[model samples]
Target: MRHHIVHAGWLTAALAVLGGVFALYVHPDFLVTLVDQIWSCF
Candidate 1:
Protein backbone atom coordinates (compact mmCIF):
# COMPACT_ATOMS: atom_id res chain seq x y z
CA MET A 1 0.00 0.00 0.00
CA ARG A 2 2.83 2.39 0.82
CA HIS A 3 4.52 1.71 -2.47
CA HIS A 4 1.30 2.27 -4.36
CA ILE A 5 0.76 5.57 -2.60
CA VAL A 6 4.30 6.73 -3.39
CA HIS A 7 3.84 5.84 -7.04
CA ALA A 8 0.59 7.74 -7.17
CA GLY A 9 2.32 10.81 -5.73
CA TRP A 10 4.98 10.70 -8.39
CA LEU A 11 2.40 10.19 -11.13
CA THR A 12 0.44 13.19 -9.94
CA ALA A 13 3.56 15.36 -9.85
CA ALA A 14 4.53 14.30 -13.37
CA LEU A 15 1.08 15.05 -14.67
CA ALA A 16 1.13 18.44 -13.00
CA VAL A 17 4.39 19.36 -14.70
CA LEU A 18 3.17 18.02 -18.03
CA GLY A 19 0.03 20.07 -17.72
CA GLY A 20 1.99 23.19 -16.83
CA VAL A 21 4.19 22.78 -19.87
CA PHE A 22 1.25 22.12 -22.13
CA ALA A 23 -0.50 25.20 -20.82
CA LEU A 24 2.57 27.30 -21.52
CA TYR A 25 3.37 25.88 -24.95
CA VAL A 26 0.03 24.93 -26.45
CA HIS A 27 -2.72 27.18 -27.64
CA PRO A 28 -6.35 26.25 -27.03
CA ASP A 29 -7.35 27.22 -30.56
CA PHE A 30 -4.77 24.85 -32.02
CA LEU A 31 -6.07 22.03 -29.89
CA VAL A 32 -9.58 22.80 -30.94
CA THR A 33 -8.64 22.73 -34.61
CA LEU A 34 -6.78 19.47 -34.18
CA VAL A 35 -9.76 17.88 -32.51
CA ASP A 36 -12.03 19.14 -35.23
CA GLN A 37 -9.84 17.59 -37.91
CA ILE A 38 -9.80 14.25 -36.13
CA TRP A 39 -13.57 14.18 -35.85
CA SER A 40 -14.32 15.43 -39.34
CA CYS A 41 -14.59 11.91 -40.75
CA PHE A 42 -17.17 10.86 -38.22
Candidate 2:
Protein backbone atom coordinates (compact mmCIF):
# COMPACT_ATOMS: atom_id res chain seq x y z
CA MET A 1 0.00 0.00 0.00
CA ARG A 2 2.79 2.42 0.83
CA HIS A 3 4.62 1.64 -2.40
CA HIS A 4 1.48 2.24 -4.41
CA ILE A 5 1.01 5.63 -2.80
CA VAL A 6 4.57 6.65 -3.61
CA HIS A 7 4.15 5.59 -7.22
CA ALA A 8 0.93 7.56 -7.50
CA GLY A 9 2.60 10.68 -6.15
CA TRP A 10 5.42 10.45 -8.69
CA LEU A 11 2.98 9.83 -11.51
CA THR A 12 0.92 12.85 -10.53
CA ALA A 13 4.01 15.07 -10.47
CA ALA A 14 5.14 13.84 -13.90
CA LEU A 15 1.70 14.46 -15.36
CA ALA A 16 1.61 17.98 -13.92
CA VAL A 17 4.97 18.85 -15.44
CA LEU A 18 3.91 17.45 -18.82
CA GLY A 19 0.64 19.39 -18.61
CA GLY A 20 2.52 22.64 -17.95
CA VAL A 21 4.82 22.05 -20.91
CA PHE A 22 1.87 21.28 -23.14
CA ALA A 23 0.20 24.49 -22.02
CA LEU A 24 3.27 26.45 -23.06
CA TYR A 25 3.22 24.91 -26.53
CA VAL A 26 -0.38 26.03 -26.95
CA HIS A 27 0.97 29.55 -27.63
CA PRO A 28 2.35 30.09 -31.15
CA ASP A 29 4.85 32.70 -30.00
CA PHE A 30 6.33 30.46 -27.35
CA LEU A 31 6.51 27.56 -29.77
CA VAL A 32 8.35 29.68 -32.31
CA THR A 33 10.84 30.95 -29.77
CA LEU A 34 11.46 27.45 -28.44
CA VAL A 35 12.12 26.15 -31.92
CA ASP A 36 14.43 29.03 -32.67
CA GLN A 37 16.50 28.37 -29.56
CA ILE A 38 16.71 24.67 -30.26
CA TRP A 39 17.66 25.25 -33.88
CA SER A 40 20.44 27.57 -32.79
CA CYS A 41 22.14 24.67 -30.96
CA PHE A 42 23.05 23.15 -34.29
Candidate 3:
Protein backbone atom coordinates (compact mmCIF):
# COMPACT_ATOMS: atom_id res chain seq x y z
CA MET A 1 0.00 0.00 0.00
CA ARG A 2 2.64 2.45 1.02
CA HIS A 3 4.75 1.51 -2.00
CA HIS A 4 1.89 2.12 -4.38
CA ILE A 5 1.14 5.42 -2.70
CA VAL A 6 4.74 6.50 -3.17
CA HIS A 7 4.72 5.50 -6.81
CA ALA A 8 1.46 7.36 -7.35
CA GLY A 9 2.96 10.50 -5.83
CA TRP A 10 5.97 10.36 -8.16
CA LEU A 11 3.74 9.65 -11.14
CA THR A 12 1.58 12.60 -10.30
CA ALA A 13 4.59 14.90 -10.06
CA ALA A 14 6.01 13.58 -13.33
CA LEU A 15 2.71 14.17 -15.07
CA ALA A 16 2.53 17.66 -13.68
CA VAL A 17 5.99 18.45 -15.03
CA LEU A 18 5.13 17.02 -18.42
CA GLY A 19 1.95 19.06 -18.53
CA GLY A 20 3.91 22.19 -17.73
CA VAL A 21 6.40 21.36 -20.46
CA PHE A 22 3.60 20.90 -22.93
CA ALA A 23 2.09 24.19 -21.95
CA LEU A 24 5.41 25.93 -22.36
CA TYR A 25 5.89 24.39 -25.75
CA VAL A 26 2.39 25.29 -26.88
CA HIS A 27 2.25 28.72 -25.28
CA PRO A 28 5.61 30.22 -24.50
CA ASP A 29 4.05 33.66 -24.28
CA PHE A 30 1.69 32.51 -21.57
CA LEU A 31 4.46 32.32 -18.98
CA VAL A 32 5.71 35.76 -19.97
CA THR A 33 2.24 37.21 -19.53
CA LEU A 34 1.78 35.41 -16.25
CA VAL A 35 5.03 36.77 -14.90
CA ASP A 36 4.13 40.28 -16.02
CA GLN A 37 0.81 40.09 -14.25
CA ILE A 38 2.42 38.69 -11.12
CA TRP A 39 5.06 41.40 -11.08
CA SER A 40 2.37 44.03 -11.51
CA CYS A 41 0.60 42.69 -8.46
CA PHE A 42 3.61 43.34 -6.27
Top candidate (lDDT): 3
Residue 40 Cα positional deviation in candidate 3, in Å, after optimal superposition: 17
Cα deviation in Å at residue 23, candidate 2?
0.2
Give the residue spans of candidate 2 off by over 4 A.
Answer: 28-42
- Give the alpha carbon lDDT tens digit for every residue of 1-42 in model 2: 999999999999999999988888787798889899999999
lDDT of model 3 at residue 12? 100
Candidate 3 backbone collisions, by pair: none
- Per-residue lDDT tens digits for candidate 3, residues 1-42, read 999999999999999999989988799799899889999998
Best by TM-score: 3
**Cα-based lDDT for every prediction:** 0.88, 0.93, 0.94
Candidate 3 wrong stretches, greater than 4 Å: 31-42
Locate the minimum summed-lDDT window of 10 residues in model 2. 23-32
User: CA RMSD for every model?
Assistant: 4.3, 2.1, 1.8
TM-score of each: 0.60, 0.64, 0.66
Candidate 3: C-alpha RMSD after superposition: 1.8
